[model samples]
Target chain A: AQSVAQPEDQVNVAEGNPLTVKCTYSVSGNPYLFWYVQYPNRGLQFLLKYITGDNLVKGSYGFEAEFNKSQTSFHLKKPSALVSDSALYFCAVRDRGWPSNTGKLIFGQGTTLQVKP
Target chain B: DAGVTQSPTHLIKTRGQQVTLRCSPKSGHDTVSWYQQALGQGPQFIFQYYEEEERQRGNFPDRFSGHQFPNYSSELNVNALLLGDSALYLCASSPPTGRDTQYFGPGTRLTVL
Candidate 1:
């Protein structure tokens, strides 16, 4: 089974400071990892994904994630945090060999990120 | 172009009642997937439909069902609603073939009383 873990339930960062939201995964085969952000009452917005290639993957809204195979982690990062960056973050993983890749997305519980000015 | 869209932004239903949620895929998308998200939790997959057929389903019970139209739009129907069913229902769309990324809709908030 493919699973994702977000150790932090919530993270606080001051505005303009760098922010990092941690994520780790467990999968039998190669993993397809994704990061999504959710605003209150809204569906998730894709941030980035790591399939294969460069360890650092850049994504929308000036966000990026590092894929560390040895650590089994893919943590989201941003150089400067904005107050508007506050939202719920989710880490998801899927098995590369899953027959129906679109059927299910193993999601972490989610992390609430708060950026204070 | 419009992204994924869902109807009935909010709904309230009583136990034992039935409800249907609608979703229109993105302009060029041919597949639709449904997910249920409880407060403070990540979304849970319900099912996926492509070419008017259910290609895959999650671990949900039989009470949860769905349909897809030839045009690629989809509907999720839940029978015998329970309080546990209360949550935000999200719809996502993507192309069935290749490395298409899934795009999501704002979601419909369902409240079972």
Candidate 2:
């Protein structure tokens, strides 16, 4: 079965420093990976995606992810973290095995990033 | 344009009670998807509706059902709700091509007591 893994339950970083949220996925075929962030009491906000073309995909709010096919990883990163950047992050992949247009997605457990001052 | 919207920002219900949650797709969107998000976990796909029909369903039981209207709004019906059913219910909308990205609504927080 296709699945995603976010090894860290929580990541702590200082404000103004670089931050990385690691995610790895396992799928039968080429993967359509995505990143989403959720703030307290809010629904998820799309960050970025890697369908094809670029290994490095940039997204909203100064976020980007690098997709590595060889390692089967798509880790989200930011050059400088802000206190507002702290939130729950999720990695997801469209299940290609399903109907081409179903839009079903398998998501990782999620990683909480805490940026302190 | 308005983003996806869900009604009843929060709800509290007892076990065995049936509940209906509504969602209005974003303007110009034709597909609506429902997901269940438990505390500390990622949202799980419940189902997707297109053209007023259920195009696909997740592993959730039949007790969890839904309907889509001509206006592209949707509703999720949960019958005989269990304590486990208490979670954040999210509604996402996509364009005619369902394979594209999904934009989520604020979500309804259901608390089963």
Tens-digit lDDT string for candidate 2 (B1-113): 88999999999999999999999988988888999999988999999998898988899999999999999999999999999999999999888664568889999999999
Best model per DockQ: 2
Give lDDT tens digits, candidate 2, residues A1-112: 8999999999999999999999999998889999999999999998999999989999999999999999999999999999999999999998763455566878899999
Provide C-alpha RMSD values for all models, in order: 1.5, 1.3
Q: CA lDDT of each candidate?
A: 0.89, 0.92
Candidate 1's residue-wise lDDT over A67-105, tens digit each?
999999999999999999999999988534234435557
Off by over 4 Å in 1: A96-101, B97-100
Question: For all the predictions, what are the DockQ values?
Answer: 0.60, 0.71
* Model 2 fnat value: 0.59
By lDDT, the best candidate is 2
Off by over 4 Å in 2: A97-99
Chain B of candidate 2 versus the native chain B: what TM-score? 0.97
